[model samples]
Target: MEFHEPVMVREVLSVLRPGPLSRVVDGTLGTAGHALEFARLIGSQGILVGLDRDPAMLAIGARRLNEAKGKDGPRLHLVARPYEEICEVLQDAGMTEGVDAILLDLGVNSLQLENPERGFAFSKEGPLDGRFNTEAQATTMADLVNNASERELADWLRDYADERLARPIARRIAARRALAPLRTTTELAELVREAYPPAQRFGRIHPATRTFQALRIAVNDEMGSVERGLKACMSALAPGGVLASISFHSIEDRITKRIFQGATDAKPDPSNPYSATTTEGLEFELPFRRPIACTAEEAESNPRARSAKLRAIRRMEVTS
Candidate 1:
């Protein structure tokens, strides 16, 4: 299977320049597409830590790195854990001081979406299991769809996917599951299509697109992970280190923007609520005022690149 080329490789490399002997982390390793590039840049003297919740992906990543790096390359520490637990990963790797650079490629990758068995795509026929870490005993998409109350379903649909027909969709799902459980991607997708107004059923995207996206997000707790993972990455950066994040949707971008802004923005004085002061210790600075977008050429070649947004920040040296 061909994993999609890592999005905005040029932009990501530009923002995160991992030099020889540098320590770097690819928080969302995927198939090691970005991690391979990082390995090449950091060289054999560097240390590369790759984290992924999926053992399958981590196995693939390790193989790819091993095959590509040969006998002489960065020391590899591929961990089967979530990026939100970076502090522990770093400490275990003996880098408690921090890494020189970190990369967080957020949202589902082509590997997961392409595999029908993983059930990440609305276009495919597969079980309603969308957990990123399939090995974990966490709630699956089927669990939520089959068991969640109508109100709960609607809330998740609206909050996670911005689905305009969330209530109707939830009602339809609740009604259908009462008779027989919605067990497959196509089953749920068709139901969502039926829930939409005839006119809206076929628009710029499939009627089931939002519902599937919302379900995957809810099943994986993606937004919460992104929030925690970004914060962990920021905290794990050594002085003068950089953290770059690539978000596929508005909500992920918003969370990244908020976290990065909070770190860089001036703080309100604790002693005087009315006064704002520059934070007195180590701080962060935005390398770019605006998020970076893929080139039109790249977007044409890789459709997924169209929605990709890259944001980066650097930790400043200690300042009293």
Candidate 2:
């Protein structure tokens, strides 16, 4: 199936400005949506490396590139791996010096959500595995619902997704699993709905929304990899390289916002609240004062664009 239109494409191109000899990386590389655009801008003179942990997505990306006249386009390298391990990917590609741009598109891609077998959405009835990489050998949503204690599950929901009804939901999940292990997304959603009060049960969003988000993140250990991936992207950039990310929810956006602002805005705690520490003239700068948002038109066309917020930082240029 064709994936949804990528979020904030215009803004991304304007900020990144891929050109000849540019070395760019799409860390998430979900179906090569952004990578395809980068390939066009970079032309045959540049390089665009696509990386995703999912082998299935990688295959799709390769096919997309091939159909897009891969031979005459910017040289493409698609790697099957997560962004956190980008250092290895770059080293293996012999790009040790660095790259010109890097992108980490955080949150669920349309491909996973639309495909029920991956089990990333509660709207469908599928196995409760929410791993980004099916081969990741990590904890699955089913494992959490079946094995974790109510307290453990509740704490996870609260801490991971900030679910306010974590206790009641976790209690219900535990009780339901005791009867029969929750195996499908529909089952979990039903359990969460039952846990909610009647009034809130039929609210605007599915009661299981936050629970699924929390489980997906925990299953993939996304939060744990954010810091590492951010640092890796920064370190992998050549002088004056652009590093960007599009985060869907507040949790990911907050992490990116704080990290981007902190580099140029961090200082001593009390005495210098506005003081920002720079590192050898290499500290990054925020090109846009605020995160770039999707246009109203794009949002109307692609509802997924409504939640996307793009943030970027540019590595400083060397000086005498």
Candidate 3:
């Protein structure tokens, strides 16, 4: 899909299990694709908080939300900042009791991937600026590729993207960047393609995909945000409230799973970053131990839904 098509909307709503006239938060409000649905679910008097780091996307989401809202639909409280600021936004909105539901769709939106200028897709040619919040003064892919040390690049690639060819790719990037800075996405993509062996270069996923993902995650501090954002979102949820998050990749899913179960996995692994296990925290209880996956039918229609792993938990009511 060219637009910001939300994956597993029905599944998300089902997992959230929002109550009527309750408050909800669409933490990654790309184009209000999901927020619009949440607005409907909450009724006119309910509150639907929308958040996005990208001003461009927040505007689009706001517009879509406004257009979809019924006369008595939930009020839209859209904010422009990383989802990590979830609690701050809610507190500022004077939400004393917290919210009843929260949905965090942690996928790279089509609004970004399809737009070459955002530099998220390897198939397209564009600048190497892959910051989700384009207006933020954050490090860009170009900055990381050009300035980060060879060892640092390799570690980052391996840690963030689980890229097997991280060492070789980092070496090549370091060498080439020394000659001339890699200013564009194509430049980095081409470098990665050359860095990969012929057998893997022609694989289903492009050679540069992992590197791009890694750089984007690094520039945006996505994993860190997820860590902090989850806690913030949970803290902002009322007792018995539900928090549903859709993780797009393995590492993120692992962290999300681990955190929800109330354990911390801080050690970094170079070979397999996602393999971290721990015990329970007891703040929230998983409705289902297994994460919900998109059905084959849904996966076929929406390619983005294929890798999505939906996990949800309800905050246990505080007892003395």
TM per prediction: 0.93, 0.92, 0.91
Which is better, 1 or 3, measured by TM-score? Answer: 1
Please give, for residues 1-320, the per-residue lDDT of candidate 2 as tens digits: 47746788888888888887899999988888888888888888888899988888888887887689555688888888989889899999999988999988887778888888998998879999988877766778899889988898898799878899999898888778888998999989888888888998998899888999888887887876776687778778888999999988777787777667766674533443223432333567889878888999999988888988889989878766
Model 1 spans with C-alpha error above 4 angstroms: 199-204, 269-281
Per-model C-alpha lDDT, please?
A: 0.87, 0.83, 0.83
**lDDT by residue for model 3 (1-320), tens:** 54587889999888886656889998999988888888877887798999998888889999888888869788778899778888789889998798889999995788888888888877878989988877675788899889989998998899988999899999999889779999888888988999987887788888888898888888888888887787778777788888899999887898788777652224534444322322233356778878899999999998889999999878788899
> In model 2, what is the error at residue 21, expressed in angstroms?
1.5
Ranking of all candidate structures by their lDDT, best first? 1, 2, 3
Which number leads on lDDT?
1
Residue 136 accuracy (lDDT) in model 3: 74
- Candidate 2 ranges with C-alpha deviation above 4 Å: 266-281
lDDT by residue (tens digit), candidate 1, 268-302: 53544222222235588999979999999999999
